[model samples]
Target chain A: MNEVIELLQSHRSIRKFTDQKIPRDLFLELIRAGQSAATSNHVQAYSIIHVRNQANREKIAELAGGQKYIADCSDFLVFCGDMKRPTDSAERAGADVIRGMTEQFLVASVDTALMAQNVVIAAESAGLGICYIGGIRNNPAEISELLKLPEHVFPVFGLCLGYPDQDPNVKPRLPVESILKEDYYREDEAMVDGFDETMRDYYGQRTGGTKDTNWSKQLSPLFNAKLRPHMREFLVKRGFELK
Target chain B: MNEVIELLQSHRSIRKFTDQKIPRDLFLELIRAGQSAATSNHVQAYSIIHVRNQANREKIAELAGGQKYIADCSDFLVFCGDMKRPTDSAERAGADVIRGMTEQFLVASVDTALMAQNVVIAAESAGLGICYIGGIRNNPAEISELLKLPEHVFPVFGLCLGYPDQDPNVKPRLPVESILKEDYYREDEAMVDGFDETMRDYYGQRTGGTKDTNWSKQLSPLFNAKLRPHMREFLVKRGFELK
Candidate 1:
C-alpha cells in the first residue's frame, strides 16, 4: 500500500497531546488542503473558527460535555455549516434566493464534513494528532453564540489538533460484508454477530479486561434515550428550517 | 508540501472516464480505507451499495439528473446513511432504542460523508477519479425503492469511480481569509467579491470563454427556487423523521 493509504488505514483519534504547537504557516497549509476537498456544486458552504482565546476555549470545553482536550489541545477549531455567504452572494447577483431548505442543510453539513476530513488527513500526514469533538452539539446554541456564528450558519462539530502525548489503538469497524452491499440493501445477521464478538474481544483487551462490552451494547447510550433533542429547534433557529 | 497534501491540493472532479475497470481487490481496498475514517461515537452508521448492473446504473443515472457519468464510470457506489443496523443491533443487545431524531439523521449523514471522503482520497492516491452525485436527492424515494433500502437507512449520495480519460482543471475556492475565522466569526465581503472575479475568470477559461457567469450567478438556480422539496418528506418516510 502507498503512504497515503497506509496513513488512512492507521488512523486513530488522539485526545492527549504534548505541548508542541503547530507552526502558523503549516496550520494555514492544512486549511488550504481542506479547501481542496470536493465541495458539492463548489458552493463551499462551510467555515472554520479557530478558538484562540484561552477563556473561550475553556468555556467551550465545559460546554462540550467537559471535553478538557478542547482547552488543552494546541489548537481548537469549530467547523460550521454556512449557507449565508453563498445565498447572500447569489442575492447580490440578482437572484431572489430562498433562505432555508432541507437540501441546503444537507449540502452545508456534508460540505463541512468533507472539508474537515481533508483537514484531518492533512494533519495526520504532517505527523500531527487529531480528534473529532462531536460533543459540540450537546450545547450548540451556546457554542454558536460564543463563536459569533451568524444566522444561516451552525457549528457542526469541533476538532482538536496537536502533537500526540498518548497513542491509542485504531478502533475496530464493522465487517466489510455488513457495510458493503452488492446491488441492494441486505441484512447480515451472521456478520453482525461475528463483529460483535470481535468488538467484545477488542474492548476487553484494550481496557485490560475491565470494560466488557461489544459494539452493540456500547451503542445503547446513544440510542436508548433521545439524542440531542434540541438539535431540530437549534438548526431551525439557525436558519436551517428543513422546509 | 508532502505527497498527500499535493494529492489533496490537485483534486478535480473527473466526469469523463476511460474504459478501464477497477480491479475488485483494489476497489475493496478503497472501501477498507473508507472504513478507517473517523465516525461519530464509532457508530459507523453507513453502508455502500455497489451498483454493477448496467440497467440499474442507467436508471440511477437518469434519477440523478441524467448524469451520464454514473452510467459511464467503471464502478458506481451509492453511499447510504444507515441507522438501521446499529439500532437493530443495539435493540437486540437489550436497549430500547428510539427510532428517529434530528441528531440521528445528522450523525448518519455526517458519518456517510466522512467515510466517502476517505474513499475519494484513497482512490485519488491510486490514480483513480471520482465524482459525488448529490442529484440523487432529486428522486430519493424512487432511488431508495430501486436499491431496496430499508427504513432507518437512506441514500446520502452516489459516487462514480474510474480511471480518468479527461484532465479537468482544479476548481478554485474562496479565499482562506473568508472561510477561516479567528476566535469568532467575521464577515469578509471584500474576499467574496474578489473570489467572484476569480471564479468569473475560471469559468470563462475552463469553458473556452463561452461561460462568462461568476460563482454567485451560477448559484442562482440552487437558491432562486425551492430545491429538492421532496427531500424532507422522503427522509421522513425513510425513518429519519428529524424529530
Candidate 2:
C-alpha cells in the first residue's frame, strides 16, 4: 500500500500508550498541520492548549469523565472553538463583534474540529497515537475555567497523543459505495447491503462469533442517554443562541 | 520543509481553476484520507458524492450560490452527513433508530467536515487545488433531493477539486499565543501584539498599503449577515429532531 493508503487502512484509536515524550519538532509539525487547515471565511476561529504538566494532565483526566488515558499519554491538547480572537481584534479595530447565534458558534466548533483531524493525521504519520476525548465537552464551563478560557471561547474536545504500547485492530468502515455517491445523491439499497456485511464481519472478528451488537444497536441508545439530552439548551446557555 | 509541511504552511482556498481532470489514483488517495479521519464512536456517518459530468457540475455550481469555479473544476464532491446507515441497521434488527437526534446530526456533520479537511490536505499534497462551498446549505432540501438523499441524510457542504493553475499567497494566521492557552484560559492583552504585527505585515504584502483588513474586519459581518438563520428548523425538518 502507498503511504496514504497504509495510513488509512492501518489507523486505529490508541487509548493506551508507552511512556515516551513526543519530540518537540514532531509536535510543532502536528500543530502546523492543524493550523494549515481551511477555516470558515479564513477566520481561523480556533486555538489549542498543550498540557505537559503532570498535575494539569491529571486534573484534565479527572475533568474529562475520569478517562485515565488523558493522564497516561505523553502529550495532551485541548482544542477550543474560539471567537475571542476576532472579538479581541474588534476591540483593536474599534468595531463591534456581534455573535450570539448557533451559526457562528458551530462555525468555530467546526473549524476547530477540522483542524484537530489534521493534527491527528500528522501525529499518526509521525508514528504517534491519538485518542479524541469528547468527554471534555461534558463540563465545558469547568474545562474552560480550568483551561482559563476567555469569554466567547469554548473547548470542543481534547486529544491524548503518545507512542502506542499496543496496536489496536483497524476499525471497519462502511463500504465505499455506502459513502461515495454518484452525480446526484442516490440512496442505493446496495449501501446497506455492503455495509451490513462489513459490520457483520467486524463484529464476528471482535467477538469470535456473531455478536448481538451492530452499528445501530450501539448508536441508538447514545442519543437517548441522559447526559446528552439537553445539549441544545446547553449550547444556548453557553452563549450560542440557536436562532 | 517536508512535502506535508509545505502543503500545510502554504494552503490557500483556490476559487479559480483551469480545466484539468484529477487522476483516478490520486482521487482515490484523497478519499482514503477522508476515511482515515476520526469519527464519533466510529459510526462514520458521512458520504461523498463525486460529480464528474459537466452538466451536473454546472447545475450544482448554479445551486451553490453562483460560484463559477465549481462548474469549471474537473471534479466536485459533496460531503454529506448521513444518519441512514445506522438507522437502516437498526431497522434490520427491528430496533428503533429514530433516536438519531440533533446531537447525532451535529456529530455526523462534524465527522464529515473533519474527513473533508483531510481530503483537502491530501489533494493539496498531490498538487491539487480545493475550495469548500458552504452555500450548499443555503437550500438544503433542494440540494438533498437533487443528490437523491434519503431521509436523515443532509448536505453539509460541497468541495471543488482539480489541479492548480495559480499560486495564491499564504493566508496569515493569528499568532500562536492568541489561541494557545497555558494551564487555564487566560484572556489578556498579551495575545494581541505579535499577531497584529504578523497579520499587518501579511496584509501589507497581499493588498497594497491602501486596503488592509485584519481578522476582526473580515469576520464580524458574518454574524451581522444572519447567514443560515433557519438552519436549526431546517435541520429538524430534514429529520434531525434536536431532542
**Which candidate tops TM-score?**
1
What residue runs in model 2 are displaced by over 4 Å at the alpha carbon? A91-94, A210-212, A223-227, B98-100, B188-190
Across B190-233, the per-residue lDDT of candidate 2 in tens digits comes to: 55656666676777777777657655555556644565776777
Question: On residues B39-115, what C-alpha lDDT tens digit does candidate 1 reach at each position?
Answer: 99989999999998899999999999899999999999999999999999889999999978999999999999999
DockQ value of candidate 1: 0.88
lDDT of 2 at B16: 78
> For residue B146, what is the lDDT in candidate 2?
74
Instruction: Give the deviation of candidate 2 from the true structure as CA RMSD.
Output: 2.6
Cα lDDT of model 1 by residue, A1-243, tens digit: 778999999999999999999999989989999999999888999999999999999999999999999999999999999999999989999999997798899999999999999999999999999999999999999999999999999999999999999988898888887899999999977898999899999989988999989988999888999999999999999989999
Clashing pairs in 2: A147-B184, A147-B185, A148-B184, A148-B185, A149-B185, A185-B147, A185-B148
> Over the true interface residues, superposed, what is the Cα RMSD of model 1?
0.7
DockQ of each: 0.88, 0.53
Task: Tell me how much of the true interface, by contacts, candidate 1 captures.
Answer: 0.82
